[model samples]
Target: MTSLPQQTDKKLGLVIDLDICVGCHACVVSCKEWNTGGYGAALSDQDPYGDHVSGSWLNRVHSYEAGEGANARVVHFPKSCLHCDDAPCVTVCPTGASYKRSEDGIVLVNEDRCIGCGLCAWACPYGAREMDVAEGVMKKCTLCVDRIYNDNIPEEDRVPACVRSCPANARHFGDLADPGSEVSLMVLARGGFDLMPEQGTKPVNKYLPPRERPAEPSSCGKRSASERESTADATGFFRWLDQALERMG
Candidate 1:
């Protein structure tokens, strides 16, 4: 069997900013659109407008509620293939179709070799793998490999479509192997945490910490931008005045 690329101990992956994510589902929708229409066949939709409507999606967004009482908060977690370092899906594959890359640390599928047994899907805990009904093969996000390498596409737009369409700019794509990369920097600065680290998959992707709100009461009711600015300016003026009086005394 051909070995998957494991270059220089560097793994490429995504670092998602949970603080900026609004749970808009834009990433989910765009991912569906691109994967459905790209080199991969349309992502299998089991039932449309039916009672049990669920389909194969490489990515899915989950909204979670946590904490108790005053400290409680809602977090929107977008789940997808972690492309784990120890991918069970690859080991379980009867064919060598599912494999990881040594050069870039990307997990990819060989659609031509897949038998459509769905065994790989069962092995994945993150539910990152998907089966293409049309092609009778399993499919998952290639991280837009075709587009990312296409010379025709612009350099700036080489990243995945989901990363491009995100209005909140919460998604980032780069080589995790490079410690100084932007994704790595943001991960360190914002304290990005992995999901299910105990599983020992060592997922390439990371999620930023949830926003921390202060204990102070939030401003209620409608207030114009100008009014809010005026209030802020007055507050600053009063603070400066107090400081000056203290110095004089």
Candidate 2:
């Protein structure tokens, strides 16, 4: 039986897989291509070749190292607007342009009403919002609303540009409100975590946890049992303790 459209509101959103993301920055490029040229506003880059290079991106990939010193690990986090249920960004906007939709959990900026005060950017702890210098207005991900709703685009290609362009397939778009939805299932199965959950953004977007690699065993491989030491001149204290413990056991 065909499911009624109203039965599940298409509250499309993104799920980021930290485990599989290679930090290739493909999604960043695709976003730049679509958004820098598309309807909202141009994502401005201050200087293409200058020493100080800064720009607006609806999406940004951040690389981090976990643990300390030699045992440290790398983590690639792709940051974007969470489109939160309790969005501080929306409420802080003095002009009332930024708002959360009841139809879908998407937080959107009404470009017509935005006054470009940039208070929303300051309000956002995730640094998801940006000001388009060229347009002199704030800009953020629209979740490809224009493309998703357009009749001309193929249904398969109607997803947000970031999800469509992800080389690692780390980004997924769907309704999180529906328990049966693919995004919902994936989040449940993976135990995905919210960034800075204490902030209480109630972000619609979820990030899959980083997969843990097996720890390498310590390199103290020498032992008296394995190798005969004629005089024990070179043996360390741990080796002597190991020999004593082995005999005691």
Candidate 3:
């Protein structure tokens, strides 16, 4: 089994704002495109136009409803490899294929060393690892490691593909190790939190909770009675896809 580094030099991660995320799925599509083409093995689709279709995807957003009445909301939860400091996936790798980088704290799989055993996926608490059925290896988010430090791309476009493609500007990437970093400050301001604190993974990525809905209508504008009564059900990322695919069938 593999072991984790005592510490990493920098904690590079993401901050997702749940309040503004429209559940558009721009991030998910962007991630699939970039990872398949730019970084690792291709993300293959099994029976894409047929039935029981499944394939590899590094990132996924699961939207679910929480709370009640005026306080209720459809939260868009984007999830991926958190690159936990005490990454269970890394420690459970018998072949030592899954490892965390000491420099940036990014958890990654060395495909050459991987045996296609699926142990890392089982060990992961976030369900972030994906099996490449075509290539017989595990794949995951690398935080666009190749793009972040590349001199070829424009400075403004160097962020992870998901962060770059989000139309609402809901995704942010930065060094979380620095207290003064923009991501850290955003966490402090928004009361960002871990996915499952009880797991003790210490995931680097933080999520800003969705703000509570106002009880009274906004004074600046008025809404039709029809709009007021309407509710958004499963309009979030993964659920939307599930509903769309079901309609096709």
Candidate 4:
């Protein structure tokens, strides 16, 4: 089995805002493109236009409607490998194929060393690991490790493809280990929470909850036309996501 690093020099990860995600799947597409292009393409599509269409992708989003009637709101939740501090997938690997990097705490799979074993997928609680049926190797988000460190790319484009391509700016990338980092401050201010924290994985990525909504209006009184318009404008997801993120401070 593989062993995890006792400590990493930097904990690089994502901070996602649930309030502004538009469920556009831009991150998903960008992740697929970058991972499959020049950066050691590992993804595969099983019958692109057939009945059972499936593809190996690192990022995905799920949407859910919370509450009902006037209190209801659609929340777009994005999911990916959280690169946990105590990554069970790494420890569960029979070979040393899966390991968490000591430099950045990024959990990654060395495809050459991998034996196409599904142990890592079973060990991951987040359902982040995907088995590439075509190649029989495990695939998951690597935090765009290649793009992040490449000097050839423009400095502003150093972030993960998903982060760079997000239209809503709902995704953020930085060193979460630094107390003063923008990502860390955002977490502190927004009360970012880990996904399935009880599992003890200590996921590096954090999610900000949807902002609190106004109190439900009384059924007895109908909303005035201007009041209704204001409410509708406020709740429009894509319309004001940029403004909201800016005001998020």
By summed lDDT, which 10 consecutive residues of candidate 3 come out lowest?
Answer: 213-222
Question: TM-score of model 4 relative to the true fold?
Answer: 0.86
lDDT of 2: 0.81
User: Could you give candidate 2's per-residue lDDT for residues 10-64 as a string of tens digits?
Assistant: 4568899998999999888888888888757778899868999988899999999
Q: RMSD per prediction, one decimal?
A: 7.2, 8.1, 12.4, 10.2
TM-score for predicted model 2 compared with the true structure: 0.81
Instruction: Rank the models by TM-score, top first.
Output: 4, 3, 1, 2
lDDT of 1 by residue, 1-249 (tens): 334344426677788887778899998998988888886567878777899987877777888889875567788888877777777788788889889877666788888888899998898888888777767899887877776777898888888877888899989998776889998898888888888888777788899988788773434325556664453334577878866876999
**Candidate 1 root-mean-square deviation in Å:** 7.2
lDDT (Cα, tens digit) per residue for candidate 3, span 186-249: 9999999998889999999999998766676532235676665544444678678877877999
Instruction: Quote the positional error of residue 173 for candidate 2 in Å.
Output: 1.0
lDDT of 2 at 101: 68
Q: Give per-residue CA lDDT, model 4, range 68-118, as digits (tens).
A: 667789999999999999999999899899999999999998888889879
Give the distance in Å from residue 2's predicted Cα in candidate 2 to where it truly belongs. Answer: 36
Steric clash count of candidate 3: 0
With a 3 Å backbone cut-off (N, CA, C), the pairs that clash in candidate 2 are none
